[model samples]
Target: MTLTSTAPNVFEAGLPTFTYGLTATPHDILDDLRTAQSCAPIAIGPLGPEILSYSMARELLRDNRFRLPPGITLAAQGITSGPLFDKLTSSLLGLNGAPHIRLRKLVSKAFTPRATSRLQDTIREVMNGLIDHVVDAGRCDVVPDIARPYPTPIICALLGAPPEDWPLFVAWTEEIFKAFNFQPDVNFDESAIMRAWGELDDYVDGMVAERRHNLTDDLLSELIRAESDGDRLNLDELRMLAAGFLMAGTDTTRNQLAASVQVLCEHPDQWETLRDHPDLAMQAVEETMRHSPAASIVPRAATEDVEFGGYLFPEGTFILVNTFAANRDPAIYDDADRFDITREDAPAILTFGGGAHYCLGANLARRELAEALVVLTRRLSAPRLVGPAPWKSLLGMTGPTTLPIEFASERL
Candidate 1:
């Protein structure tokens, strides 16, 4: 594959291109990526790791040679030791090989189809209750009013966290998510991050202690008692796992829900399709995920010097898989840029990372999204955007911070 003419323009413009650890306007960047995808399956930069194409992105995720970078913990960039250091270091996202395999196995049970199936009623109740709050008003900001609050109670219930502590968990997760920004030049407040981590650690430790004495049906208790082949998660591992699950399930689901509503409102035809064929809730969620995945970029590092797509990626090279780009790769999907729920061969989207590190909470996230759409379409009619939805500027997850929508007023 050869580099396209647009490649030179990306570097010359100095606009903090997507691969350069900076957040660009996603639509514009995606257009550039689609053009580039036609020319090559991979593009190697002067100083950075290779930028993967749609096919290459899927391949590299399953490839063992490319592993998560070591020391990439939630302890901020420069801090070596802190409250979040041990927890983040022990997280499933930060580990590989035997450790990652072991932790994932223990936690995977909670997110299984059977397990999430049990939460169907609870999820429906949560969605309906949220809709009840805004139904009378006839309009509401999707982010704070609906999407932001919908998942917390469910996540808390799954984790055996106290419902009252939902607000605190939200605060801590916000601070923790900042550590995920991969931009090399971004500045983070080490002190505030450490403080949040400290408080969260103490809270999680208390929950662990309580669950150890009295196991319950919740996920946290299950993790405490979970054993396989005489192996179990240690104290620190339990705390980190609980915290990680909370953070992982919360913000990403919030963003995806908001994005789905924004997209559906913008495309009335698609919204009507969902409203008419409520059974297509899953397809609508999948379409939203394909069109606008929560996390646009995922980072990985080469464990060893290896050649991929005819380029030599040296050991320790940082690779950024532009998921937003690959999801829209024209070669992979017909009319890839358009939002169409009825695409027969929709092709799997990499919104959730693939292979050994596939998202543990994927089932739960899907259930939440499907249920939210089902309830919304059934309760509200002719939902449309009140104004332009503004997106968050973070380089990691891409979604609207405020998505205001107005719909025909009707009471269930």
Candidate 2:
């Protein structure tokens, strides 16, 4: 995979023109985008959409004039859709303004400080149990063995689904996310994606129906009972929210966990620092979020003519905020490219985004990553990567698809 930028012509003097090859990986593309960001905070290019830097990206996300475009659809983009499209487009991620606010308010309770704090013990137990499975083996692939398997169960428990059904959830999510790939030349298996979506939708609908008859002490049940003023989520909204929570909460965390482990292993000094001072696990998680964000890009569309950073963006212009670059902005962090867990004053990264559309599961993700690190460091002695971790080529989400590690066997 190769990415090359041609020298700017006379008219577009300062701006570099990027040309991305079909084989370019997401990280490679991001590297090019970061270089472009350094040249200018905002750049207009021929190959891709306009790219925004850290400050400008933050501004664009917070501004009401920039919104999630309604015209963007899986079907319109030549991808088949069924319940997946309906659920995602109707959920909080797809909406803006009052409707988004109302749904967010209702859903926020499940992710509050108190709520997430209560799950620490559960998360710890889950992580340790996963480690326990591989402790005797002395070697394991962290992605499939641990990271990929951990989050779905935790999210399932929170969503009032059976923990035993996590593997099924993972399978469905894998298929559904295929439709999310944005690389220019990638081809998704539309039939498989739609099939998985239908199965997942029916499964969620069943859970919703069961919950309505007999509510339980779970986030899904609470959402079912939740009322804002005189309004409540309709059946479609309920199903969508439940499915969205599972998908959104699990996917990013799964990738982040794998990426975090890969980063820690690559930088042994940092890993040792974390191992020695277990309290710094959270800091390590923050640093990982900054240095190697799992979700690399966020897309937005201008609702009205906006002029900023010496560029005029007409309404409907799509903006791609390169968070992978923004988090590594040299202006924002001293020695930004280096991964240092001890840095105390690092600014918040755009990994979870900003303003109105900030990730609802941010706290949960932080806790999960921190807990995974704590357990890994505590249970294993100097775990080393088996080889170079292979990162996924997906555009929006970037992380190791396989992270094999070997460590001294230790009893829990």
Candidate 3:
């Protein structure tokens, strides 16, 4: 596809800077992204040296030549690299085109609906178990106790992580994701990253060894048994996949849950509506996905000149698709700034993404959020915000650092 304009594209403009309001709430970001998309899929960046912002998510999703920029590495300050580096940036979700498709197909077998159905029981149990501890506390830090670790245990059970080491997995994932916000010039050191990466690789390597010895009814064991032409994931692939699952399930779901709660707090009327109907949980989730998306952007590298709307994106441009921005386009959703959960068109949110690279864990995440809200609404007599929810300064996933909710219930 060729761009329509004769004007030089944004990619040729220079590096991206913080001009587009990176700190803006999800709604504002979406508005800007929509404007950019209508004008051109590519534009000058808002946070770095002159870079291209690819805002047409649907179009980019359809094309396969647009690769993830090498500079757009998902590496954490202290937890990525070495034998397990491939998990975040080189796994099924990381690759582009055919190789990515093949790997995803192999992994998709384990994520089938039937397989996920079996985890609902565990999901309910995990939610209740966490609530059991903090239900009567009046208030607690929701991010760490409930939102962050909630997805870990469920995924561990699905992946067959040993009970004793589940806590360790949680710690490793926290270190990896928290690195997204690390400003090395001020807060981090090389030794800290080295230590974190070493521990992560060592733990995953041990798990790989165990899965090899005793294949169980979990994803890790199943992968060990999976083969093609007598070839399977070697040690490096094994470690990376394990790390990938941990990071994906942990950060994405935690932030989604946290952001959902924040949005509900901001719109008590909408919260009451959902509390009354309960079934609106699904719609509420979609609204949260759109209004306060967990992930802020998706990066891509153009392999050929592509045109969309009315502009050109030349080959070798570093592209950033502001998913958060696309969800809030005024033309697409009426009163896009408001947090109304009951809107008839609220279900069209782009939270789980679009196209082939859509999140594989979307079903699992919805299940967790739905179940959590069900139990939470019924048990808590009155829930109110204790303080303003503070968002983390992360480049990718946007979530809260602390969320304290006051409630009368002893346990949810």
Candidates in order, TM-scores: namely: 0.87, 0.87, 0.81
- Order the candidate numbers by lDDT, best to worst: 2, 1, 3
Query: What stretches of model 1 exceed 4 Å from their correct place?
Result: 1-21, 44-52, 71-86, 182-188
> Each model's C-alpha lDDT?
0.75, 0.75, 0.66
Regions of candidate 3 where Cα sits further than 4 Å from its true position = 1-8, 11-45, 48-55, 71-88, 178-214, 225-235, 345-347, 410-412
The sequence of per-residue lDDT tens digits that candidate 1 reaches over residues 1-412 is 2233322332233223224334454664565565556666655432344354678899888888888765463422564666556556667787899888888887765454544566778888888888899998999999989998888778887877776787897788777776665444254666676688779889988988988888777787778777888888888888788778877888899899998888888898888888889889988988999897777766788786666655656666777777777788887888888898877767888989888888888878888899999888888888988887877643567789798889997624
Candidate 3: how many backbone clashes? 14
Between prediction 1 and prediction 3, which has the larger lDDT?
Answer: 1
| Stretches > 4 Å off in candidate 2 | 1-14, 26-34, 45-52, 70-77, 80-87, 183-192
Q: What is the lDDT of residue 31 in candidate 2?
A: 67
RMSD of every prediction: 4.9, 5.2, 4.4
Q: Candidate 3 — worst ten consecutive residues by lDDT sum?
A: 47-56
Cα displacement (Å) at residue 396, model 1: 0.7
With candidate 1 superimposed using the best TM-score fit, by how many Å does residue 152's alpha carbon deviate from the native?
1.5
What lDDT is reached at residue 232 by model 2?
Answer: 84
